[model samples]
Target: MSDNPKPTVEGGSDLPGWEWDRTVEDSEAVAVGDSVTFSKDITDDDVVRFAEASGDTNPLHLEDDYAAETRFGGRIAHGMLVGGLISAALARFPGTVVYLSQDFEFKGPVRIGDRATAEVEVADTLDGGRYQLSTQVLVDDEVVIDGEAIVLIDEAP
Candidate 1:
Protein backbone atom coordinates (compact mmCIF):
# COMPACT_ATOMS: atom_id res chain seq x y z
CA MET A 1 0.00 0.00 0.00
CA SER A 2 2.82 2.41 -0.28
CA ASP A 3 2.73 4.55 -3.40
CA ASN A 4 5.28 2.24 -5.00
CA PRO A 5 4.11 0.52 -8.16
CA LYS A 6 5.37 -2.81 -6.84
CA PRO A 7 5.24 -4.24 -3.37
CA THR A 8 8.47 -3.79 -1.45
CA VAL A 9 10.17 -5.21 1.59
CA GLU A 10 11.99 -3.43 4.40
CA GLY A 11 14.82 -2.39 2.11
CA GLY A 12 12.59 -1.04 -0.69
CA SER A 13 13.48 -4.03 -2.80
CA ASP A 14 10.70 -5.53 -4.85
CA LEU A 15 9.14 -8.71 -3.54
CA PRO A 16 10.14 -11.38 -5.95
CA GLY A 17 7.45 -13.41 -7.72
CA TRP A 18 4.59 -11.38 -6.29
CA GLU A 19 2.05 -10.18 -8.81
CA TRP A 20 -1.39 -8.57 -8.76
CA ASP A 21 -4.09 -7.32 -11.11
CA ARG A 22 -7.17 -5.16 -10.90
CA THR A 23 -10.16 -4.75 -13.17
CA VAL A 24 -10.67 -1.10 -12.37
CA GLU A 25 -8.13 1.24 -13.95
CA ASP A 26 -9.33 4.36 -12.23
CA SER A 27 -8.96 3.55 -8.57
CA GLU A 28 -11.02 6.66 -7.87
CA ALA A 29 -14.01 5.10 -9.56
CA VAL A 30 -14.42 2.00 -7.45
CA ALA A 31 -17.76 0.36 -8.05
CA VAL A 32 -19.63 -2.93 -7.96
CA GLY A 33 -17.63 -4.27 -10.88
CA ASP A 34 -14.27 -3.40 -9.35
CA SER A 35 -12.17 -6.42 -8.53
CA VAL A 36 -8.60 -7.28 -7.66
CA THR A 37 -6.54 -10.45 -7.62
CA PHE A 38 -3.24 -11.18 -5.91
CA SER A 39 -1.04 -14.21 -6.45
CA LYS A 40 2.07 -15.61 -4.80
CA ASP A 41 3.61 -18.88 -3.90
CA ILE A 42 3.27 -19.80 -0.26
CA THR A 43 6.85 -20.71 0.41
CA ASP A 44 8.41 -22.58 3.30
CA ASP A 45 9.78 -19.29 4.56
CA ASP A 46 6.33 -17.81 4.45
CA VAL A 47 5.00 -20.59 6.67
CA VAL A 48 7.77 -20.25 9.22
CA ARG A 49 7.66 -16.47 9.32
CA PHE A 50 3.88 -16.50 9.66
CA ALA A 51 4.07 -19.07 12.43
CA GLU A 52 6.56 -16.96 14.32
CA ALA A 53 4.69 -13.72 13.79
CA SER A 54 1.23 -15.12 14.58
CA GLY A 55 2.33 -17.48 17.41
CA ASP A 56 0.40 -20.26 15.76
CA THR A 57 2.96 -23.01 15.90
CA ASN A 58 0.41 -25.69 15.23
CA PRO A 59 2.08 -29.02 14.46
CA LEU A 60 -0.08 -29.26 11.36
CA HIS A 61 1.70 -26.27 9.98
CA LEU A 62 5.21 -26.82 11.33
CA GLU A 63 6.14 -30.31 12.43
CA ASP A 64 6.41 -32.39 9.30
CA ASP A 65 6.37 -35.77 11.00
CA TYR A 66 3.46 -34.78 13.17
CA ALA A 67 1.62 -33.43 10.18
CA ALA A 68 2.39 -36.61 8.24
CA GLU A 69 0.32 -38.53 10.74
CA THR A 70 -2.68 -36.30 10.30
CA ARG A 71 -5.38 -36.26 7.62
CA PHE A 72 -3.51 -33.70 5.58
CA GLY A 73 -0.55 -36.15 5.58
CA GLY A 74 1.88 -33.25 5.42
CA ARG A 75 2.47 -29.77 6.63
CA ILE A 76 -0.15 -27.33 5.42
CA ALA A 77 -0.11 -23.56 5.48
CA HIS A 78 -2.04 -21.98 8.31
CA GLY A 79 -5.62 -21.11 7.45
CA MET A 80 -5.22 -17.52 8.52
CA LEU A 81 -1.99 -17.26 6.61
CA VAL A 82 -3.84 -18.19 3.46
CA GLY A 83 -6.70 -15.95 4.38
CA GLY A 84 -4.28 -13.05 4.63
CA LEU A 85 -4.19 -13.10 0.87
CA ILE A 86 -7.53 -11.42 0.87
CA SER A 87 -5.97 -8.49 2.61
CA ALA A 88 -3.28 -8.44 -0.01
CA ALA A 89 -5.91 -8.16 -2.71
CA LEU A 90 -7.67 -5.40 -0.88
CA ALA A 91 -4.50 -3.38 -0.56
CA ARG A 92 -4.31 -3.11 -4.33
CA PHE A 93 -7.42 -1.01 -4.45
CA PRO A 94 -6.85 2.50 -5.82
CA GLY A 95 -7.49 4.41 -2.66
CA THR A 96 -6.14 4.11 0.82
CA VAL A 97 -8.11 1.00 1.68
CA VAL A 98 -9.00 0.55 5.31
CA TYR A 99 -10.00 -2.93 6.30
CA LEU A 100 -13.16 -3.02 8.39
CA SER A 101 -13.81 -6.72 9.01
CA GLN A 102 -13.53 -10.07 7.36
CA ASP A 103 -15.09 -13.50 7.79
CA PHE A 104 -13.59 -16.64 6.38
CA GLU A 105 -14.35 -20.33 6.01
CA PHE A 106 -11.21 -22.22 5.04
CA LYS A 107 -12.30 -25.03 2.77
CA GLY A 108 -9.10 -26.98 2.07
CA PRO A 109 -5.41 -27.38 2.69
CA VAL A 110 -2.59 -25.42 1.04
CA ARG A 111 0.72 -27.14 1.19
CA ILE A 112 3.94 -25.19 1.42
CA GLY A 113 4.99 -23.98 -2.04
CA ASP A 114 1.45 -23.91 -3.37
CA ARG A 115 0.64 -20.96 -5.59
CA ALA A 116 -2.30 -19.34 -3.89
CA THR A 117 -4.41 -16.71 -5.62
CA ALA A 118 -6.84 -14.45 -3.80
CA GLU A 119 -9.63 -12.64 -5.60
CA VAL A 120 -11.88 -9.91 -4.21
CA GLU A 121 -14.74 -8.17 -5.96
CA VAL A 122 -16.84 -5.25 -4.90
CA ALA A 123 -20.35 -6.57 -4.37
CA ASP A 124 -22.02 -3.43 -3.11
CA THR A 125 -21.20 0.17 -2.36
CA LEU A 126 -22.20 1.43 1.03
CA ASP A 127 -22.57 4.92 2.38
CA GLY A 128 -19.40 6.80 3.33
CA GLY A 129 -17.09 5.10 0.82
CA ARG A 130 -17.47 1.67 2.42
CA TYR A 131 -17.75 -1.43 0.28
CA GLN A 132 -18.92 -4.98 0.79
CA LEU A 133 -16.77 -7.39 -1.09
CA SER A 134 -16.99 -11.05 -1.98
CA THR A 135 -13.63 -12.66 -1.26
CA GLN A 136 -12.04 -16.04 -1.92
CA VAL A 137 -8.67 -17.74 -2.25
CA LEU A 138 -7.98 -20.47 -4.76
CA VAL A 139 -5.28 -22.99 -5.47
CA ASP A 140 -5.15 -24.48 -8.95
CA ASP A 141 -8.71 -23.35 -9.55
CA GLU A 142 -9.94 -24.98 -6.33
CA VAL A 143 -11.46 -22.68 -3.79
CA VAL A 144 -9.44 -23.09 -0.61
CA ILE A 145 -11.05 -20.21 1.25
CA ASP A 146 -14.34 -18.39 0.86
CA GLY A 147 -15.66 -15.36 2.66
CA GLU A 148 -16.65 -11.72 2.56
CA ALA A 149 -15.22 -8.45 3.79
CA ILE A 150 -16.06 -4.82 4.35
CA VAL A 151 -13.62 -1.99 3.85
CA LEU A 152 -13.46 1.77 3.75
CA ILE A 153 -11.76 3.25 0.70
CA ASP A 154 -10.56 6.72 1.48
CA GLU A 155 -8.98 9.26 -0.82
CA ALA A 156 -5.21 9.37 -0.91
CA PRO A 157 -4.01 12.23 1.24
Candidate 2:
Protein backbone atom coordinates (compact mmCIF):
# COMPACT_ATOMS: atom_id res chain seq x y z
CA MET A 1 0.00 0.00 0.00
CA SER A 2 1.40 3.39 -1.04
CA ASP A 3 0.48 6.83 0.12
CA ASN A 4 1.89 8.49 -2.99
CA PRO A 5 -0.61 10.58 -4.93
CA LYS A 6 -1.60 9.09 -8.28
CA PRO A 7 0.21 10.52 -11.30
CA THR A 8 -1.53 12.33 -14.13
CA VAL A 9 -0.98 12.41 -17.89
CA GLU A 10 -1.00 15.44 -20.15
CA GLY A 11 -2.12 15.88 -23.75
CA GLY A 12 -1.17 13.47 -26.51
CA SER A 13 -1.63 9.72 -26.94
CA ASP A 14 0.84 7.12 -28.19
CA LEU A 15 -2.04 5.66 -30.16
CA PRO A 16 -4.48 8.13 -31.62
CA GLY A 17 -7.51 8.72 -29.37
CA TRP A 18 -6.34 6.22 -26.77
CA GLU A 19 -5.08 8.06 -23.71
CA TRP A 20 -1.97 6.43 -22.15
CA ASP A 21 0.02 8.14 -19.45
CA ARG A 22 2.94 6.76 -17.44
CA THR A 23 5.00 8.63 -14.84
CA VAL A 24 7.70 6.23 -13.66
CA GLU A 25 11.36 5.87 -14.52
CA ASP A 26 12.58 2.36 -15.30
CA SER A 27 16.11 3.01 -14.14
CA GLU A 28 14.97 4.10 -10.73
CA ALA A 29 15.65 1.53 -8.03
CA VAL A 30 12.62 -0.57 -7.17
CA ALA A 31 10.75 0.63 -4.12
CA VAL A 32 7.56 -0.31 -2.36
CA GLY A 33 6.07 2.97 -3.43
CA ASP A 34 6.60 2.31 -7.13
CA SER A 35 3.47 1.94 -9.27
CA VAL A 36 2.04 2.59 -12.75
CA THR A 37 -1.44 2.78 -14.25
CA PHE A 38 -3.35 3.65 -17.43
CA SER A 39 -7.00 4.01 -18.34
CA LYS A 40 -9.27 3.82 -21.37
CA ASP A 41 -12.98 3.76 -22.02
CA ILE A 42 -14.32 0.38 -23.09
CA THR A 43 -16.12 0.73 -26.41
CA ASP A 44 -18.28 -1.44 -28.65
CA ASP A 45 -15.37 -1.46 -31.08
CA ASP A 46 -13.11 -2.71 -28.32
CA VAL A 47 -15.45 -5.59 -27.50
CA VAL A 48 -15.86 -6.56 -31.13
CA ARG A 49 -12.13 -6.48 -31.69
CA PHE A 50 -11.42 -8.56 -28.61
CA ALA A 51 -14.12 -11.05 -29.44
CA GLU A 52 -12.80 -11.46 -32.94
CA ALA A 53 -9.19 -11.78 -31.89
CA SER A 54 -9.78 -14.06 -28.90
CA GLY A 55 -12.46 -16.24 -30.44
CA ASP A 56 -14.34 -15.88 -27.17
CA THR A 57 -17.68 -15.18 -28.77
CA ASN A 58 -19.75 -16.01 -25.75
CA PRO A 59 -23.20 -14.49 -26.17
CA LEU A 60 -22.82 -12.72 -22.86
CA HIS A 61 -20.21 -10.52 -24.47
CA LEU A 62 -21.45 -10.45 -28.05
CA GLU A 63 -25.21 -10.74 -27.93
CA ASP A 64 -27.24 -8.26 -25.94
CA ASP A 65 -30.44 -10.26 -26.23
CA TYR A 66 -28.67 -13.40 -25.06
CA ALA A 67 -26.99 -11.60 -22.23
CA ALA A 68 -30.18 -9.90 -21.08
CA GLU A 69 -31.56 -13.27 -20.10
CA THR A 70 -28.62 -14.05 -17.86
CA ARG A 71 -27.65 -12.74 -14.45
CA PHE A 72 -25.83 -9.84 -16.09
CA GLY A 73 -29.06 -8.66 -17.73
CA GLY A 74 -27.09 -7.09 -20.60
CA ARG A 75 -23.92 -7.48 -22.58
CA ILE A 76 -20.68 -7.43 -20.58
CA ALA A 77 -17.08 -7.23 -21.59
CA HIS A 78 -14.98 -10.42 -21.48
CA GLY A 79 -13.11 -10.85 -18.23
CA MET A 80 -9.85 -11.36 -20.14
CA LEU A 81 -10.45 -8.21 -22.14
CA VAL A 82 -10.80 -6.28 -18.91
CA GLY A 83 -7.78 -8.11 -17.51
CA GLY A 84 -5.73 -6.85 -20.42
CA LEU A 85 -5.98 -3.47 -18.80
CA ILE A 86 -3.80 -4.84 -16.01
CA SER A 87 -1.26 -5.94 -18.59
CA ALA A 88 -1.43 -2.44 -20.05
CA ALA A 89 -0.55 -0.98 -16.68
CA LEU A 90 2.30 -3.45 -16.23
CA ALA A 91 3.75 -2.44 -19.58
CA ARG A 92 4.34 0.99 -18.08
CA PHE A 93 6.87 -0.28 -15.57
CA PRO A 94 10.21 1.49 -15.79
CA GLY A 95 11.85 -1.45 -17.58
CA THR A 96 11.01 -4.21 -20.00
CA VAL A 97 8.54 -6.28 -18.03
CA VAL A 98 7.86 -9.88 -18.92
CA TYR A 99 4.90 -11.54 -17.32
CA LEU A 100 5.85 -14.64 -15.38
CA SER A 101 2.55 -15.35 -13.68
CA GLN A 102 -0.74 -13.72 -12.80
CA ASP A 103 -3.83 -14.57 -10.73
CA PHE A 104 -7.22 -12.94 -11.17
CA GLU A 105 -10.67 -12.77 -9.69
CA PHE A 106 -13.46 -11.27 -11.80
CA LYS A 107 -15.65 -9.57 -9.27
CA GLY A 108 -17.97 -7.48 -11.43
CA PRO A 109 -18.99 -6.66 -14.97
CA VAL A 110 -17.47 -3.96 -17.17
CA ARG A 111 -20.07 -2.57 -19.53
CA ILE A 112 -19.33 -1.00 -22.86
CA GLY A 113 -18.41 2.69 -22.55
CA ASP A 114 -17.27 2.35 -18.96
CA ARG A 115 -13.95 4.05 -18.38
CA ALA A 116 -11.57 1.46 -16.93
CA THR A 117 -8.23 1.82 -15.23
CA ALA A 118 -5.46 -0.74 -14.76
CA GLU A 119 -3.31 -0.20 -11.72
CA VAL A 120 -0.25 -2.10 -10.44
CA GLU A 121 1.76 -1.43 -7.32
CA VAL A 122 5.12 -2.91 -6.43
CA ALA A 123 4.60 -5.10 -3.42
CA ASP A 124 7.86 -7.03 -3.34
CA THR A 125 11.09 -7.21 -5.27
CA LEU A 126 12.50 -10.68 -5.68
CA ASP A 127 15.99 -11.75 -6.48
CA GLY A 128 16.89 -12.39 -10.16
CA GLY A 129 15.22 -9.27 -11.53
CA ARG A 130 11.67 -10.14 -10.61
CA TYR A 131 8.95 -8.17 -8.89
CA GLN A 132 5.61 -9.03 -7.34
CA LEU A 133 2.81 -6.52 -7.77
CA SER A 134 -0.70 -5.90 -6.64
CA THR A 135 -2.91 -5.66 -9.72
CA GLN A 136 -6.41 -4.31 -10.03
CA VAL A 137 -8.89 -2.87 -12.50
CA LEU A 138 -11.61 -0.44 -11.63
CA VAL A 139 -14.63 1.05 -13.34
CA ASP A 140 -15.28 4.34 -11.64
CA ASP A 141 -14.86 3.47 -7.94
CA GLU A 142 -15.91 -0.14 -8.20
CA VAL A 143 -13.31 -2.88 -8.24
CA VAL A 144 -14.20 -5.13 -11.17
CA ILE A 145 -10.99 -7.17 -11.28
CA ASP A 146 -8.52 -7.94 -8.54
CA GLY A 147 -5.25 -9.76 -9.01
CA GLU A 148 -1.51 -10.10 -8.49
CA ALA A 149 1.35 -10.58 -10.89
CA ILE A 150 4.98 -11.58 -10.88
CA VAL A 151 7.09 -10.07 -13.65
CA LEU A 152 10.65 -10.30 -14.82
CA ILE A 153 12.14 -6.93 -15.67
CA ASP A 154 15.34 -6.22 -17.53
CA GLU A 155 16.89 -3.06 -18.82
CA ALA A 156 15.85 -2.32 -22.40
CA PRO A 157 18.31 -3.76 -24.87
Candidate 3:
Protein backbone atom coordinates (compact mmCIF):
# COMPACT_ATOMS: atom_id res chain seq x y z
CA MET A 1 0.00 0.00 0.00
CA SER A 2 2.89 2.40 0.73
CA ASP A 3 4.10 1.95 -2.78
CA ASN A 4 0.96 3.51 -4.24
CA PRO A 5 1.21 7.13 -5.43
CA LYS A 6 -2.19 8.21 -4.11
CA PRO A 7 -4.00 7.51 -0.88
CA THR A 8 -7.70 8.04 -0.11
CA VAL A 9 -7.61 11.64 1.16
CA GLU A 10 -9.62 13.90 -1.14
CA GLY A 11 -9.08 17.36 0.43
CA GLY A 12 -8.08 19.51 3.41
CA SER A 13 -9.90 21.94 5.68
CA ASP A 14 -10.53 25.54 4.65
CA LEU A 15 -12.92 26.21 7.48
CA PRO A 16 -13.13 29.62 9.06
CA GLY A 17 -12.09 30.53 12.63
CA TRP A 18 -9.22 28.00 12.77
CA GLU A 19 -5.62 28.97 12.02
CA TRP A 20 -2.12 27.51 11.97
CA ASP A 21 0.66 29.30 13.86
CA ARG A 22 3.19 28.93 11.07
CA THR A 23 3.57 27.48 7.61
CA VAL A 24 7.02 26.24 6.55
CA GLU A 25 7.60 25.81 2.85
CA ASP A 26 10.63 25.65 0.53
CA SER A 27 13.11 24.46 3.11
CA GLU A 28 16.85 24.39 2.42
CA ALA A 29 17.05 20.62 2.01
CA VAL A 30 15.95 17.34 3.56
CA ALA A 31 18.70 15.09 4.84
CA VAL A 32 19.19 12.53 7.60
CA GLY A 33 18.47 14.18 11.00
CA ASP A 34 16.58 17.09 9.43
CA SER A 35 13.09 17.78 10.81
CA VAL A 36 9.72 19.41 10.11
CA THR A 37 6.97 20.53 12.48
CA PHE A 38 3.42 21.87 12.74
CA SER A 39 1.67 23.05 15.88
CA LYS A 40 -1.94 23.86 16.74
CA ASP A 41 -3.93 24.79 19.78
CA ILE A 42 -6.37 22.00 20.62
CA THR A 43 -9.78 23.38 21.43
CA ASP A 44 -13.14 21.87 22.37
CA ASP A 45 -14.31 22.87 18.93
CA ASP A 46 -11.55 20.81 17.37
CA VAL A 47 -12.51 17.77 19.45
CA VAL A 48 -16.16 18.01 18.56
CA ARG A 49 -15.41 18.40 14.89
CA PHE A 50 -13.18 15.33 14.95
CA ALA A 51 -15.84 13.26 16.64
CA GLU A 52 -18.41 14.25 14.06
CA ALA A 53 -16.03 13.46 11.21
CA SER A 54 -14.54 10.21 12.54
CA GLY A 55 -17.71 8.78 14.12
CA ASP A 56 -15.70 8.14 17.30
CA THR A 57 -18.07 9.49 19.92
CA ASN A 58 -16.55 7.56 22.80
CA PRO A 59 -17.68 9.54 25.87
CA LEU A 60 -14.07 9.68 26.88
CA HIS A 61 -13.68 12.09 24.02
CA LEU A 62 -16.98 13.93 24.31
CA GLU A 63 -19.10 14.05 27.46
CA ASP A 64 -17.28 15.65 30.36
CA ASP A 65 -19.32 13.70 32.89
CA TYR A 66 -18.49 10.34 31.36
CA ALA A 67 -14.82 11.15 31.04
CA ALA A 68 -14.56 12.56 34.57
CA GLU A 69 -15.43 9.12 35.96
CA THR A 70 -12.69 7.51 33.88
CA ARG A 71 -8.91 7.53 34.40
CA PHE A 72 -8.51 10.58 32.16
CA GLY A 73 -10.58 12.67 34.65
CA GLY A 74 -12.16 14.79 31.90
CA ARG A 75 -12.96 14.77 28.23
CA ILE A 76 -9.87 14.00 26.21
CA ALA A 77 -9.03 14.45 22.56
CA HIS A 78 -8.88 11.52 20.18
CA GLY A 79 -5.46 9.91 19.75
CA MET A 80 -5.78 9.95 15.99
CA LEU A 81 -6.37 13.70 16.08
CA VAL A 82 -2.88 14.10 17.41
CA GLY A 83 -1.67 11.74 14.70
CA GLY A 84 -3.21 14.04 12.14
CA LEU A 85 -0.89 16.78 13.32
CA ILE A 86 1.98 14.44 12.54
CA SER A 87 0.53 14.05 9.08
CA ALA A 88 0.36 17.82 8.82
CA ALA A 89 4.05 18.06 9.65
CA LEU A 90 4.91 15.48 7.03
CA ALA A 91 2.96 17.42 4.44
CA ARG A 92 5.45 20.26 4.87
CA PHE A 93 8.06 18.08 3.22
CA PRO A 94 9.81 19.67 0.24
CA GLY A 95 7.80 17.55 -2.20
CA THR A 96 4.62 15.57 -2.21
CA VAL A 97 4.66 12.71 0.29
CA VAL A 98 2.46 9.65 0.50
CA TYR A 99 2.37 7.96 3.87
CA LEU A 100 3.22 4.29 3.52
CA SER A 101 2.72 3.16 7.12
CA GLN A 102 2.67 4.46 10.68
CA ASP A 103 3.31 2.74 14.03
CA PHE A 104 1.96 4.63 17.03
CA GLU A 105 1.96 4.29 20.81
CA PHE A 106 -0.31 6.54 22.87
CA LYS A 107 1.69 7.36 25.97
CA GLY A 108 -0.52 10.05 27.50
CA PRO A 109 -3.88 11.75 27.19
CA VAL A 110 -4.41 15.07 25.44
CA ARG A 111 -6.79 17.24 27.38
CA ILE A 112 -8.98 19.88 25.78
CA GLY A 113 -7.30 23.30 25.22
CA ASP A 114 -3.83 21.82 25.24
CA ARG A 115 -1.26 22.93 22.69
CA ALA A 116 0.26 20.01 20.83
CA THR A 117 3.30 19.96 18.60
CA ALA A 118 4.16 17.27 16.11
CA GLU A 119 7.84 16.80 15.34
CA VAL A 120 9.18 14.45 12.68
CA GLU A 121 12.86 13.93 11.90
CA VAL A 122 14.44 12.06 9.08
CA ALA A 123 15.77 8.86 10.64
CA ASP A 124 16.95 7.08 7.53
CA THR A 125 16.27 6.53 3.89
CA LEU A 126 15.28 3.48 1.87
CA ASP A 127 15.62 2.67 -1.79
CA GLY A 128 13.10 3.87 -4.42
CA GLY A 129 12.40 7.41 -3.09
CA ARG A 130 11.35 6.27 0.37
CA TYR A 131 12.30 7.83 3.73
CA GLN A 132 11.92 6.53 7.26
CA LEU A 133 11.02 9.23 9.80
CA SER A 134 11.10 9.28 13.56
CA THR A 135 7.79 10.81 14.67
CA GLN A 136 6.67 12.25 18.00
CA VAL A 137 3.89 14.47 19.30
CA LEU A 138 4.58 16.46 22.45
CA VAL A 139 2.27 18.28 24.81
CA ASP A 140 4.04 20.82 27.02
CA ASP A 141 7.40 19.02 26.89
CA GLU A 142 5.92 15.59 27.57
CA VAL A 143 5.89 12.95 24.88
CA VAL A 144 2.26 12.03 24.27
CA ILE A 145 2.57 10.00 21.09
CA ASP A 146 5.63 8.40 19.55
CA GLY A 147 6.10 6.37 16.39
CA GLU A 148 7.81 5.93 13.07
CA ALA A 149 6.47 6.30 9.57
CA ILE A 150 7.52 5.16 6.12
CA VAL A 151 6.73 7.65 3.34
CA LEU A 152 7.16 7.79 -0.39
CA ILE A 153 8.01 11.19 -1.93
CA ASP A 154 7.07 12.12 -5.45
CA GLU A 155 8.47 15.00 -7.42
CA ALA A 156 5.93 17.77 -7.63
CA PRO A 157 3.95 17.90 -10.90
Candidate 4:
Protein backbone atom coordinates (compact mmCIF):
# COMPACT_ATOMS: atom_id res chain seq x y z
CA MET A 1 0.00 0.00 0.00
CA SER A 2 1.15 3.55 -0.68
CA ASP A 3 2.05 5.72 2.32
CA ASN A 4 -0.34 8.55 1.42
CA PRO A 5 -3.91 8.49 2.58
CA LYS A 6 -6.68 9.42 0.18
CA PRO A 7 -8.05 12.93 0.50
CA THR A 8 -11.46 12.95 2.13
CA VAL A 9 -12.57 16.41 1.08
CA GLU A 10 -12.65 18.38 -2.14
CA GLY A 11 -10.01 21.12 -2.58
CA GLY A 12 -7.92 19.52 0.20
CA SER A 13 -4.16 19.82 0.19
CA ASP A 14 -1.89 16.95 1.14
CA LEU A 15 0.76 18.92 3.01
CA PRO A 16 1.03 18.92 6.82
CA GLY A 17 0.92 15.51 8.41
CA TRP A 18 -1.37 14.71 11.28
CA GLU A 19 -0.06 13.63 14.68
CA TRP A 20 -2.10 12.08 17.45
CA ASP A 21 -1.63 13.17 21.05
CA ARG A 22 -3.42 10.85 23.46
CA THR A 23 -2.69 12.71 26.71
CA VAL A 24 -4.54 15.94 25.96
CA GLU A 25 -7.50 16.49 28.28
CA ASP A 26 -10.79 17.94 27.02
CA SER A 27 -12.18 20.29 29.67
CA GLU A 28 -11.51 23.86 30.78
CA ALA A 29 -13.12 26.94 32.24
CA VAL A 30 -12.88 29.77 29.74
CA ALA A 31 -12.31 33.06 31.50
CA VAL A 32 -15.19 35.51 31.40
CA GLY A 33 -14.69 38.52 29.13
CA ASP A 34 -12.14 36.78 26.91
CA SER A 35 -12.97 37.39 23.26
CA VAL A 36 -12.09 36.25 19.75
CA THR A 37 -12.78 37.92 16.42
CA PHE A 38 -12.54 36.72 12.85
CA SER A 39 -13.43 38.15 9.47
CA LYS A 40 -14.03 36.79 5.97
CA ASP A 41 -14.93 38.32 2.66
CA ILE A 42 -18.27 37.01 1.51
CA THR A 43 -18.46 35.95 -2.10
CA ASP A 44 -21.10 34.50 -4.38
CA ASP A 45 -19.10 31.27 -4.39
CA ASP A 46 -19.20 31.23 -0.62
CA VAL A 47 -22.95 31.63 -0.61
CA VAL A 48 -23.38 28.90 -3.18
CA ARG A 49 -21.05 26.55 -1.37
CA PHE A 50 -22.76 27.13 1.94
CA ALA A 51 -26.10 26.55 0.32
CA GLU A 52 -24.88 23.30 -1.21
CA ALA A 53 -23.35 22.07 2.03
CA SER A 54 -26.24 23.15 4.24
CA GLY A 55 -29.05 22.09 1.88
CA ASP A 56 -30.74 25.47 2.33
CA THR A 57 -31.76 26.56 -1.17
CA ASN A 58 -34.39 29.12 -0.37
CA PRO A 59 -34.96 31.51 -3.27
CA LEU A 60 -33.97 34.35 -0.99
CA HIS A 61 -30.56 32.74 -0.69
CA LEU A 62 -29.95 31.43 -4.20
CA GLU A 63 -32.05 33.48 -6.56
CA ASP A 64 -31.14 37.13 -6.91
CA ASP A 65 -34.33 38.03 -8.79
CA TYR A 66 -36.55 36.27 -6.29
CA ALA A 67 -34.67 37.93 -3.47
CA ALA A 68 -35.00 41.35 -5.09
CA GLU A 69 -38.76 41.10 -4.80
CA THR A 70 -38.51 40.42 -1.06
CA ARG A 71 -38.15 43.04 1.61
CA PHE A 72 -34.41 42.42 1.73
CA GLY A 73 -34.00 43.70 -1.88
CA GLY A 74 -31.49 41.00 -2.89
CA ARG A 75 -30.07 37.63 -2.09
CA ILE A 76 -29.55 37.11 1.63
CA ALA A 77 -27.45 34.39 3.12
CA HIS A 78 -28.89 31.78 5.38
CA GLY A 79 -28.83 33.02 8.96
CA MET A 80 -27.22 29.81 10.18
CA LEU A 81 -24.36 30.20 7.72
CA VAL A 82 -23.60 33.63 9.17
CA GLY A 83 -23.86 32.34 12.73
CA GLY A 84 -21.62 29.40 11.76
CA LEU A 85 -18.72 31.79 11.30
CA ILE A 86 -18.54 32.05 15.07
CA SER A 87 -17.45 28.41 15.05
CA ALA A 88 -14.43 29.48 13.04
CA ALA A 89 -13.60 32.05 15.70
CA LEU A 90 -13.82 29.42 18.41
CA ALA A 91 -11.71 26.96 16.45
CA ARG A 92 -8.99 29.54 15.89
CA PHE A 93 -8.62 29.99 19.63
CA PRO A 94 -6.90 27.54 21.94
CA GLY A 95 -8.95 24.87 23.68
CA THR A 96 -10.39 21.38 23.39
CA VAL A 97 -13.97 22.44 22.84
CA VAL A 98 -17.40 21.06 22.06
CA TYR A 99 -20.56 22.97 21.23
CA LEU A 100 -23.42 22.41 23.65
CA SER A 101 -26.07 24.73 22.30
CA GLN A 102 -26.68 27.94 20.39
CA ASP A 103 -29.34 30.65 20.56
CA PHE A 104 -29.27 32.94 17.51
CA GLU A 105 -31.28 36.00 16.55
CA PHE A 106 -31.15 37.24 12.96
CA LYS A 107 -31.21 40.99 13.17
CA GLY A 108 -30.67 41.85 9.51
CA PRO A 109 -30.29 40.33 6.10
CA VAL A 110 -26.75 39.56 4.91
CA ARG A 111 -26.31 40.22 1.21
CA ILE A 112 -23.68 38.85 -1.13
CA GLY A 113 -20.26 40.59 -1.21
CA ASP A 114 -20.65 41.84 2.34
CA ARG A 115 -17.63 41.04 4.47
CA ALA A 116 -18.81 39.30 7.61
CA THR A 117 -16.90 39.41 10.85
CA ALA A 118 -17.75 37.51 13.96
CA GLU A 119 -16.84 38.49 17.49
CA VAL A 120 -17.28 36.03 20.32
CA GLU A 121 -16.86 36.72 24.01
CA VAL A 122 -16.90 34.48 27.00
CA ALA A 123 -20.09 35.60 28.66
CA ASP A 124 -20.51 33.48 31.81
CA THR A 125 -19.79 30.07 33.19
CA LEU A 126 -22.80 27.94 33.85
CA ASP A 127 -23.29 24.79 35.92
CA GLY A 128 -22.00 21.40 34.73
CA GLY A 129 -18.97 22.56 32.80
CA ARG A 130 -20.94 24.69 30.36
CA TYR A 131 -19.93 28.23 29.42
CA GLN A 132 -22.08 30.92 27.86
CA LEU A 133 -20.55 32.51 24.76
CA SER A 134 -21.96 35.71 23.36
CA THR A 135 -21.45 36.31 19.66
CA GLN A 136 -22.04 39.04 17.12
CA VAL A 137 -21.84 38.76 13.37
CA LEU A 138 -21.26 42.03 11.57
CA VAL A 139 -21.32 43.00 7.94
CA ASP A 140 -19.43 46.21 7.22
CA ASP A 141 -19.77 47.14 10.90
CA GLU A 142 -23.51 46.57 10.80
CA VAL A 143 -24.68 43.92 13.23
CA VAL A 144 -26.51 41.17 11.38
CA ILE A 145 -26.70 38.39 13.93
CA ASP A 146 -26.56 38.30 17.71
CA GLY A 147 -26.51 35.10 19.69
CA GLU A 148 -25.40 33.09 22.66
CA ALA A 149 -23.56 29.79 22.50
CA ILE A 150 -23.11 27.16 25.16
CA VAL A 151 -19.95 25.09 25.02
CA LEU A 152 -18.15 22.51 27.12
CA ILE A 153 -14.39 22.44 27.42
CA ASP A 154 -12.00 19.94 28.88
CA GLU A 155 -10.30 21.29 31.98
CA ALA A 156 -7.04 19.76 33.08
CA PRO A 157 -7.62 17.25 35.83
TM-score of 2: 0.87
The TM-score-based order of candidates, best leading, equals 1, 2, 3, 4
Best by TM-score: 1
Best by lDDT: 1
In candidate 1, which residue pairs clash? none
For each candidate, give its TM-score against the true structure. 0.93, 0.87, 0.83, 0.76
RMSD of each: 2.5, 4.8, 6.4, 7.7
Model 4 regions lying over 4 Å from their true place: 1-29, 155-157
Better by TM-score, candidate 3 or 2 = 2
Backbone clashes in model 2, listed as residue pairs = 26-94
CA error at residue 76 for candidate 4, angstroms: 1.3
List clashing residue pairs in candidate 3. Answer: none
Mark the regions of model 2 whose C-alpha exceeds 4 Å error after superposition. 1-13, 20-23
lDDT of 2: 0.81
> Residue-wise lDDT of candidate 4 within 16-110, one digit each (tens)?
32211111122353577766676766678878999899888999989978999999898987888888878766654455567988888889988
- lDDT value, candidate 3, whole model: 0.78
Residue-level lDDT tens digits of model 3 in 27-56 = 334567777776777889889999999999
- Model 2 agreement with the true structure over 23-78: per-residue lDDT tens digits: 45753476676888778889899999999999999999999889999998899999
Q: Write the candidate numbers in order of decreasing lDDT.
A: 1, 2, 3, 4
